[model samples]
Target: MPHFKLNYFDIRGFGEPSRMIFHYAGQDFEDRRWAREQWPEIKPKLVGGKFTGKFTASDTGASPWLEVDGERIYQSVAIARYLGNLFCLAGKDGMENAQIDAMIDSYKDYLNDARAFFWVKSGMGQGNLEELKTKFDEASKRFFTFLQKRIEKVGSGFIASKISWGDFFLADGIKTTMNFDEEFEKKFPKMVEYKNFIFSQPKIKEYIEKRPESVF
Candidate 1:
């Protein structure tokens, strides 16, 4: 087995899903994190600065990188998928895998579009909360609606009537979206159940109950 090392900030941001996947797989990994204040120095050593392309980032050069055999693998989605294959979290067939991938892409697109307003712009950067709220609602509603139909067709599991890496994507996503509005779950009970189901895994529950808390 390949030894694993993951590098990211000391927050849930984009790293938690991979972490959750690791725990769900009952695999141990090196979880390296730095405080936000250390980003400036770290960035230059990794990407977008002095090091530039030496170490890759998610999609561009952000973080939450996975290391194997002294080689770095960038991007959280791929990391999760890799672990999924090792842990039996992958779909039974190619078609199911494609479906899961599509969901992952949809959520990532939402993040790219809303990052400015919801994260850096609105409350902090330059975007406004009002606009962020509107965008957040639109994305959340669309995802939840899509998920509802999917669950109805699949029966129980998040996709393909079984648990898969796709569950981790939405497990984190539903929680993150719910942060935008406390009552968000009230509108989609099935979605709430989905979130609850993912977190209910014994290993995942243990991790959540004992993992060090961070502000992200």
Candidate 2:
């Protein structure tokens, strides 16, 4: 058995990347998910003195944590990076690693902006749909355009030369954006191609085909 345990809600959200990483690496780990209704009973036990004595984070309330080798690893990005390094999915060299970092940073910025827009427009009462749409349009165009150019330059189906964590990040971003607006592909053809290409990868395709689909 692997010495790793992943704890998160029964959704993709932040835990999806780590789950994908483990799957791609063929690593055996425990995937522990809590249902929404069961959270009341489970939360206290997971966070109480019993479990908390063995696992603790700076913020004990945070979910999507990784417990490995009897050590608690907090923060989603940190967990992803650690797994990436362990599985040799980061890059081959320092410069290549830097490229991965740049790509992940850009992707994170796009996600943050898109998520903000989503939260603001969800209520619809005090939100400005037009303004939020405009903001999303601009951010999406710039980020996807840059990604398209990078993929073209790399001449690989992935963001980096070889498969890396950033590729999954990019794929998830494209999937989320396309989910939000069906017309997203019409707006960005290159991004659409990129998304399809990433999905076509043997491991990724297999992962998607078998993984459970749930709303985050």
Candidate 3:
């Protein structure tokens, strides 16, 4: 196995899915998080290096990047898909994989919508607290309903019948979103169950417990 090097900030943003993927796959990798202040020095090298690239940060360029086996890989989704394929985490066959992809897409859309409303618009006067609450309430309800149905259909207690990249994606999404409030969890009991189920996985639990708590 190549030494998987994940580079990002300490926050559980982009690199988290990759970390969970590798952990669920029982793969060993290094999680490297840089402080915001350190980016000035590091950004230049990343831009000037062989895999020169830039991503948007605050409307400019700040992308989550990764380097696998000494080669650079940009974009969080691409990294997740690549790792999923490499580790047989995409599911069993073509149809199954496509289903996994659809689920991933759906989850991404949910996150994007939430980001836009909560992080971008809520406090900017573009929308008020009621508006934000309404948006989140609707989105979360829809997500919870869909996930509950999916789990029932699959009958496996997972988004996919077998473990796939979507599982990790959902796990991370559940963990992050649940930070909002108890009401969110109450409104989405299935999701809460799903999240707990993923966390209970031996490997995932080990990773969470053993992971360093220091802000990187």
Candidate 4:
């Protein structure tokens, strides 16, 4: 097994999926986290002061990058997908794998659209809270509705026919959204159930219980 090191901000924002995959596969890794204050010192060494404000920032200049046997890999999804394939959380065949990738890509699109509302909610940006909330709720309903149908079509406990990276990605995304809304479960019962199914796994549950708390 190669030595694995994951570097990211202390927050779970883009790193938790890979961490969860590590635990699920029983792979030990160095979860190197940096506090916001410490990022300045480390940022120069990692990305050399490149801040694109894009989620798909260059791997060389992004948080949530990974190193395996000292070889670096960039981008959060790239890292998570790599771990997923490494740990056997990927589909068994080419077609299933393509479908899983398609699902993840769709979720990314939804997340990109939702980021504005999340920023305002976190107080990191300014916007009308009520208006954003209304818009987010509408958008979430659409996204979750599509997700629920996908799960039902698969007829498996996970988003795919078998356990795959899509399960972790989609579940974690919904879990994050639910953190801010007390009524989330009521509004999206099926999605909540799906999230619960993935999170209830023994290793995932243990990780979540022991992981450091973050407002995000």
Best by TM-score: 4
Mind sharing the TM-score for model 1?
0.87
Residue-level lDDT tens digits of model 1 in 1-216:
788999998978788888998888888899988777766655635434435432333334478788887777788888889888878989889998998898888878777665665574325576567777778778767867887788788886576668898788778777766665678778998888888888988998988889876433
lDDT of 3 at 137: 72
Q: Give the residue spans of candidate 1 off by over 4 A.
A: 45-60, 120-122, 214-216
Q: What does candidate 3 score on TM?
A: 0.81
RMSD to the hidden true structure, all candidates: 3.2, 3.6, 4.5, 3.9
* TM-scores for the candidates: 0.87, 0.83, 0.81, 0.89
Please write out the lDDT profile of model 2 over residues 47-126, one tens digit for every residue. Answer: 44544332233236667889898788987778888899999888878987888789888888887767766656545235
Cα-based lDDT at residue 211, candidate 4: 91
Candidate 3, which ten residues in sequence have the lowest lDDT sum?
Answer: 51-60
lDDT of each: 0.77, 0.77, 0.72, 0.82
Global lDDT for candidate 3? 0.72
Cα lDDT tens digits, model 4, 173-207, are 98889876778899889888899899999999999
lDDT of 1: 0.77
Which numbered prediction scores highest in lDDT against the true structure? 4
Q: Taking the tens digit of each residue's C-alpha lDDT, what string does model 3 give over 63-179?
A: 466677677788787888899899987777888778777877877777766664555332433656557767777777777687778878988888777777778778777776776
Each candidate structure's count of clashing pairs: 4, 0, 4, 0
